[model samples]
Target chain A: MQIFHRSTNTISRATIFGAVFVVAALFWVAATVQRSPYVTYAGVARPQPAPFSHQHHVAGLGIDCRYCHTSVETSSFAGIPPTKTCMNCHSQIWTNAAMLEPVRESYRSGKSLVWNRVNDLPDFVYFNHSIHINKGVGCNTCHGPVDRMPLMYNYASLQMEWCLDCHRAPEKYLRPREQVFNMRYQEPSSSQPVLVDGQPYTDQLSLGMDLVKKYKLRTATDIMSCSTCHR
Target chain B: MRNCRKISLLGALMLLLAGCRQDMHDQPRFKPLAESDFYADLRSARTPVEGTVARGQLHEDTYFYTGKIGNNPGDFMPFPVTEEVLARGRERFDIFCAPCHSRLGDGNGFVPSRGFPRKPPSYHSERLRKAPLGYFFDVISNGFGIMPDYASQIPARDRWCIIAYVRALQLSQNATMADVPSGEKVPSELPRFEEPGSGATLPVVEPKSANSAPEEPK
Candidate 1:
């Protein structure tokens, strides 16, 4: 026992206290990393086979979201437009543009041009686009300023915590059903009042809370339950 | 004995670490449009087998699906046209048809202006005004002239809705002052827009004056 100096005891005691801080620091780092773009790919524009701009098609041409995503109202998956959809316009306009070659080739060869999944979720989480859409969630509410996007990217972290934040308090973001697809839909304000069921509201909270009751949204506890998203 | 026990404990810890695999995050099931290695095409979602129809999708209502009575287009709707139906029709029409036909059905939509050679016919034309609703439905179901069949993009019910709206549009264009009901003002307040036709958004349009016909695109 005498082989080590008395200072070794002080060093060992300091190491034990520092170990607690070290573990906590590791946990904090892990959490920050998990939510960062490095882990969730949020806010990062992914490279697709074609650099399709939503700004050009949606905002510029005033195309509705339903034009390409045909089954958003009816199905769990918001239907990706088949290559035929691209060809619908591309066949006539921009026929020889080098940028449209992937679309043209996919149309000609009949092989699917693998577009990168911008807002992919884990295999465990079950999401339904129709139910959320029918319940008066705006496309921009979750997707963010899609009309302004030159290239597509996921706007949210797509994490369990992020899902629960809305599930716990969806009334905060509920909008009029008609305004669901409007990319430029603004939150209610004094200058910009929103009408829901013919009653104008100048604030978001009152409109949202009323919409919560009007839309017959599930109870917070029910929506926040474990089985709601994960079976 | 103690050295051997410590080694065993470390081995157990290593085994625990080895269990952290991504099997659950990427389970061996296909999502919609997921890629597959087993299929040569690498498409996980398969097309329906040739000539086979899915159950409950028989689409037995010939008039609903085809809009035809006896090899000729029918003149009426398979379902009752309510305000809700017309609204649905207008929304669908704007998304699908308005790109070429224009919201006015005047054949001056953004797509035609963007070098699309064949301009969609104006609904206000005398021949089109006389055309049966089913004729429009058939044209939307099957390709007509340079236009492609929108059967894949638009469901049957929606295609019917578009026709209903198109009929409304035709009537709106050709109405006489006598068609105005008793007390309503002739020209109610026209919507004011902040800016005219920016490429990003549609400008509020004034109602076309009665004297002005649907002009041909030069």
Candidate 2:
């Protein structure tokens, strides 16, 4: 009877142990399966409505960045041109092209293009484009070499720390505004002539420098604060 | 000992389960007032509240001070057309502008190369060159003609930057090498009048109108 009792006790312990092990294994497998390879949510990997290329627009066309992206000075969005805006050119120009498929689809269907946002900020953060642009932050300083990119990609991480570092010491990132779009700021060994529209870059750089002192905008934080960006 | 352990574990489980039940009736209950003068009469009619704050005013937060952007006309309206402002404008211009308009400020971007319609405007267009500052401001603030409004996307300052850049674009299109600063080397690659990648890749251009070609000057 004693031996039978001991065997029963051992069997009960093994059963509990086996059940615990099974539960743990199942959890591990479920976790592994939940994570997919294609998901790039951590960085700017949201799918865009149409493939937009900065390289084609800036480097190739010489169209001022302001032409399509109108919001740099007044608002936060650097606003994506609406369907009607796209129609302005597409109506007469690329009257029939596959690349303009999305534009046509939206126009014909009367549906607003639900463009997936790439450089999205957290809900709590409040980023204003007017302040930065006014204070002399170039679009390329944060966006990277957009003129070279065929498809728009988030070049800078845009993390809080990254923004703060520049804010802490803007001069490190802030150059004469003429250098704002010049991607290879560090490359040139000697003074290269600056040209705008076809004029000298001297005046433009001088204006940017003067504005920096006038505003007393020392750091990104001075202009960009928790409430400034967070709302 | 085993029974005691089981009882403690069961108690803990019961506590956890109790904590997990959803509670929808957690909000405070209050009776609606019959009269409009609830503020002055609430004390006499019902329980007197301890405090009340005024409503319906603009929330004067940090944005009023730190968030103030653009050319503020009242306080110290230094002309934003200064050299520094223009420089900043140039940087922003290149980042955002050069894509559609070529470096030479001609409207030939990758879109044309891809055979997408809509040729960019030439910076040399007389209308654009003579456009007023406010007109430019309006176009940048609220998109004009083919353009869309930039109010929400770009801040006012950046718009100014683009405007500064636009001036540069205009200058570059019209200026000669002599106009360029002594040290500044003229950009080697002239702006492409033709689309860059369209020659071999895209389909043959078909005439949109029935009579695509203009009647030969007779």
Winner by TM-score? 1
The model with the greatest DockQ is 1
Best by lDDT: 1
What tens-digit string does per-residue lDDT give for candidate 1 at A27-73?
99988987899988999999999999997898778777888999999
Which pairs clash inside model 1? none
lDDT, candidate 2, residue A185?
Answer: 38
Q: Give candidate 2's error at residue A30 in angstroms.
A: 20
Q: Which ten residues in a row have the lowest lDDT in candidate 2 chain A?
A: A187-196
Worst 10 residues of 1 chain B by lDDT: B209-218
For the predicted complex of model 2, DockQ is 0.07
Superposed Cα deviation of residue A28, candidate 2 (Å) = 22
